[model samples]
Target: MQKPRLIASDIDGTLLDPFEQITVRTAAMIRRVIAADTPFVLVSGRPPRWIPPVADMAGLDGYAVCANGAIVYDIAAARVLSVHGLDALVLHDVVHALARVLPGIKVATERAEPGPDSAGAPFATEPGYRNPWGDAESNVRPRAEVLGHTATKLLVRHEKMTSEEMSLAATELLGDAVDVTFSTNRGLIEISAPGVTKARGLAEVAELVGVARDAIVAFGDMPNDIEMLRWAGHGVAMANAHAEVLAAADEVTAPNSQDGVAMVLERWF
Candidate 1:
């Protein structure tokens, strides 16, 4: 493969190991890439606030595509460059739609206020909502109030359905209204505005930096990463990636536990 002009990677299961830590070797390789003047962008399903620690660990001080591509953030600057969010009305429609398809669905919303201090933006979840990641800062509000405002992304989970099942139900029910995908193996499904995806966010950044799609190499490990993998000039999927993600990638590398990202980068940069 040709030398990448820019490197874009997912955070949770692609760049971090099984323990959610960036190994010395991986960090060193990432720093090496930056030293060679290539822009390394963190593309993730995580909200903006969740990106800082990961960036700090990898020693990255650049841009990130957050909220599964609904947001573009500058890490070191602590500013939101742009946002493609879901309107409150659309979110309300989605919630009602899902409730009809799958009873007892819980909803959460992520809305990052635009500008330098998005870290304090509200993350609202309804009562009885179970945040698997243990987010204590989220405002536990009534579902009506939570769905009354625009959001960068919407998270919905069912008490009895799997993530895959939720994805299918949302896709068939909310087609063209929202983009549905899941980053975790659990029951939660993430929803974004139509056409908002890691690929869309990365494309916006590539245009800003004067890099073409063919000059970028992206790595990921989940269904949410599928569009990005297919969009990049060369897409590498970690061996431990979801089945659809593996099929979407151009090449498969070692799992994240084995430093898969670094393994692939070593051969090129």
Candidate 2:
């Protein structure tokens, strides 16, 4: 098989291990690929602030499809290359309407905040429940007053309800105005701007890099990653991936705990 010129990967459950850390083997493989001038993109539902550490760890200096494709970020430059956001008015209306339907549910907006380093701002003051990826102490903040900034994505966290239930409620309430998907197993729902997704984000990155969509490979392991996986020339789903993701992909790799991404790189490179 012809090797892809670019690789895009979802972070949480596809590239990272169970503890959310990238394995040494994966890191080395990423570095090797980057050294070979292959652009490795980290396409994820994570906010811009939470992406740098992962990018740095992987030795990638390309763009990140953040907030499920609501924002495409130039990671090396620490700037937003493009953004698809919900207008302030629409965001407020949706939040309010969702609150009425699912009382006590946490509603948070993920945005780029000024960071302490040259890597740009991290996701600041997410208003919803704690981050479900075990980074609660870093990403969680107290509920605060909502403002009128453009929202890259809206996150809903419900303790007693399943993500499927919350997603259905959101669809019923908001209809086609927003796109919703879940990346974690913690019943959190991520709502993005209509028509925006990680696949679209990868397309944008591919355009900027002058790489064709058919020259890119992608890895993912959840429902949120289905479109991205299907969009790539070679889509690889982790062994532990959702059925939908597995069915959509071109192939399956080892589980995340076993360094599935690294195994693919080893075999391909």
Candidate 3:
């Protein structure tokens, strides 16, 4: 097989181990790939603020496709190259529609604060929104207030529905107006602007680096990563990936705990 010119991998459950740390072997492989002139971009549903540390862990400081394809971040420079955010009016419309369809749903918006440094409370959740991660950076407000402005991503949760169910319902109701996908198995769904996805984000980076889709190898392990996995020339799903993700992938590698990404890259790098 021809070696890939670029390597893109999801962070949480694909690159990081169960402990949420990059293992020595994996880091070594990442550095080796870069040393060989291969660009490794971290494509994830995580916001830009959360990408730098992970990039540091992997000993890389290039570009990262963040917020499920909503933002392109430059790691070393700590700058956001671009953002395809959800407009305020559109967010309000989507939230209202979702609330009607999925009763008892809660909403949150992730706004990309202006300026280079990602300061301030960019995450706002509506009342009754249960934060699964107990994030301290979140601010609680009324539902209307939460959806009253533009955002990088809109997060919705329903106590009675799994992430998959919410994603399906949102996709059905919203159609092409927005992109719906979930990164975790928890009862939460991440919504972005129409056509915003990790695939789209990675494509932008690929064009910047002059790598074609046929020469890119991507790795992921969640439903949010399905589009990216399918968009790359080689889509590799981790062994522990969601069923939907596994089905979408061109091949399966070891689980995150076993350094799935490194396993696949070693073959080419």
Clash number for each model:
0, 4, 0
lDDT against the true structure, per candidate, is 0.91, 0.80, 0.90
Name the candidate, 1 or 3, with the larger lDDT value.
1
Error of 3 at 265 (Å): 1.1
What TM-score does structure 2 among the candidates reach? Answer: 0.87
What TM-scores do the predictions have? Answer: 0.97, 0.87, 0.96
Error of 3 at 261 (Å): 1.0
In angstroms, how far off is 248's CA in candidate 3? 1.0
Off by over 4 Å in 1: 115-121
How does model 2 fare in lDDT? Answer: 0.80
Output the better candidate (2/3) by lDDT.
3
Which candidate ranks first by TM-score, i.e. highest? Answer: 1
lDDT of 3 by residue, 1-269 (tens): 49999999999989999999999999999999999999999999888888878998898899999999999888888888998899889988998899898989988999874556556577899888886666666799888888877899999988788998889899999999999999886889999999999999999999999999999999999988999989999999999999999999999999999988898888877
Name the regions of candidate 2 deviating beyond 4 angstroms: 113-128, 133-144
lDDT per residue for candidate 1 within 3-122, as digits (tens), equals 999999999899999999999999999999999999999999998878999999998998999999999898888888999999999999999989998899999999975765445446
